[model samples]
Target chain A: MDSENLENINQMLEQDAELREKIKDQVTEFDKKTRVMTGLLNKIHSTPTNQLPALLDSVQPVLYSCSDVTAEIADLVPANQFWRWKDTWCNSLRNAVFVATLIEFLRSESLMTIQQVSDILGIQPSWKDRFVLTAEDYLHGVISLVNELSRLAVNAVTMGDFEQPIKISNFVKDIFAGFSMLNLKNDTLRRRYDSLKYDMKKIEEVVYDVSLRKLAPSTRDA
Target chain B: MAEQPQTGSLKSRTAIVVVFETFRNELDEHNDRRERLIKNSRDVTNLSKKVIFLLHRIMTEDEPTPKPNNDRASRAAAKGREKLKEVQNLFASIRGEVEGDRFWRYQRNVSPGLQEYIEALSFAHYLDTGALISFNQVQQSLSDEHGVPYFPLTLEDYLLGLSDLTGELMRYAISAISQRGGRTIAREVCTFVRSCRADFETLTPYYKELRKKQAVTSQSLQKIEDATYAIAVRTSEYDLPPEMLDDVVAMVSGS
Candidate 1:
């Protein structure tokens, strides 16, 4: 490959690792918050009904924030590749179900509302579909950066992995589910991300601008 | 003469009422139909469970006495039964939602469906990359992988660019309906818009092609549009920035 094509191909692979890493971070965050909420759910199960809302309130932020991000992360992967999430998407998808159920539970006055659970579960596929595409651009790009070193260990030709290769693979079974897409040529990808060496200088500007924070938060802002 | 003048005025007034009533009735009708679609989807989903229960009962029953030494037939029957049951349920659930709702609700709800559809976008990317290299190999070597080039100049990317032409027609229809305020045209526009969402795969390549062609084609198109807008509306030509509006027009035209 010419230097430019090599560069383009390299950029593609780099973005893939970056995307994976970003998702890993988000997933870790998701797991941490969910573990806390899961424990809280158990506590609420025992607490008097009157104290339940307070209990639920504490987890609500976690659920909503986690969900919003997971949904955002879901954008990183394709809805069709819901499988790439492997166990991660499973937990988060279920977590979303639980949170959605919690929302229903709150409204149901605590009577074990399967209706809400089922409703959330039913809509799970739909929600997954909507958020998957947008997420992949973000996901693959971030994952590539996180694993840049691991990638270069191999060669692009006859190599198991490229130092930075662009990929978007889907398990046919997951053909209809999540973002399994990976590409190096997508110019419009990750244009919205406001992070990196560049955004570091803008941290002070971001804090004072509430609207900016609302749209996106740095690791520090989150 | 006075009577004729009164008749004309009365006819005009009635025409006005008819126009007003058509819009009012159409909007109300659309609203009612949308509600019905939602309710029908719910009812179908509920009905699916009952059907599943019946299928399970039938499947669990003892096999027929004639048990043709092979279990394959019976097993295949059971599997088919299960699959059919799922299909029936799926259709029941989505039937109303897909077929009956008015245009606005469809637009609102359709985004979720579009999201799902677009999520598989990487597949297209993968295919394009693989095909590009494979076709290049076939053409370069004239090897057994023999065939015309994949996504050749006039093939893959061409259709991709051409879809932009359709999208422009779509935008024009939308603006026309919005400006004219009649369901007759609006209904057609609604189909155009919904097709943009529902049948995206059919359009994806075309849209992709259009996007590619945009780089070269947009400059001229924008100049034409800007000049037209400047003269027709007597607005400042500078208001519509060339690069921005050109792409916007290209995108709108593609959809």
Candidate 2:
């Protein structure tokens, strides 16, 4: 090959490397915002359920700022090349997703849909020629949400909220049953799914402890 | 402690089930597509390897020295080109599977086979023309009848594949040097390999794996230089006939 041809190839590769460096910078900024949100959410384990609304309200500004950083990341990534640079930011994105899912659950005691998570993160849900949240990332986020909920269940009982454990137990079981319907391959998702049963067992034991002591308020009161 | 909360929980539970059902379908479709691409890539790799082997056999079968216009050399090039059609067909069959954004999604699954195909194609090109194939030429060969490319050719794969070509060239040069009237071809290959190594050195820092492949290229260059130097030394020392010199060089190189 001629010298000009080799020079052109090197130029293209150098451009790709430069773009990656730019994207990585934005991802680091995105990661910093998520860590702040995670620190705020960690307080939910100690706060009583009645006080959760105020805690979630405090996270809204940070979450919006996180979405702003995500926009910067989206602008840096070239079209149709999300998967090429995905490795740089996927773990941080998954953590952001988990934070969003947990906040939604604490606000309404319901699971967040993938579309809703995408809306919160201000990214597209479609896997086309744009920056998008992949299904694998969403699933990983939900698995992490389950893990956090189990920890919440144990701490809720410690705070004299016996009924919260029962709710978390039932919700976790329903989510586990949903995961079972999936035909998972032997990948990172499968390994995470396999470890999910331990979390399920932990939540189940919290429910068992509360029920054995008749700590739940009598249903006749309804 | 209200009946409304129980009903609300039941409603959300059903919503969770429906949402996960949709996720299951999406995951299944993705897994199936990935599996298909992986299988096709393996088939491509196998076919490309056979093409490389076929070219090596045909070009070196009976000729003591390769000539640009030799009847056997042209026949060997023709046979290699014909065999490569099967490898091309394998690539064409998977073109739709990697269309648009999907190409980047499954690029890892496709890269190994694509790199092997590049190696075989460039080696064949070198055998026919006695020169390195250009990147555009390799990319053009992967396009369709209307000149539409199946997917963009990655520069990393093209470079790595060419690095592998040095190994084959080393084998070809050493084998040829042991044959009668093969000294000129050996010196020519030595210069070509040296040029390839010098050019590739500038690219080592940009590609992580290319640095590793560069190590292998250095070894190949060393062997070619050593073999050529031995021949030069022996020829300068003795004015022996070509056939006897061939035996002496062959015995000395142990090839």
Candidate with best DockQ: 2
Clashing pairs in 2: none
Can you give the lDDT of residue A168 in candidate 1? 11
Best by TM-score: 2
DockQ of 2: 0.48
Any idea what lDDT model 2 has? 0.82
Model 2 per-residue lDDT tens digits across residues B181-255: 667768888999999999999889888899999999999999999999988888888888756877776678866
| Residue-wise C-alpha lDDT for candidate 1, range A1-222, written one tens digit per residue | 124533543454466568778788877776777677666765643454456678878876766565456556656764334433444554554454445444433444121122233332333446443333222322333322222211221222123221111211111112111112222123432342222223322322333343343532332356
Which portions of model 2 show Cα errors greater than 4 Å? A125-127, A219-222, B1-11, B63-74, B239-255
Q: Score candidate 1 by DockQ.
A: 0.01
What residue runs in model 1 are displaced by over 4 Å at the alpha carbon? A1-9, A78-87, A102-222, B1-255
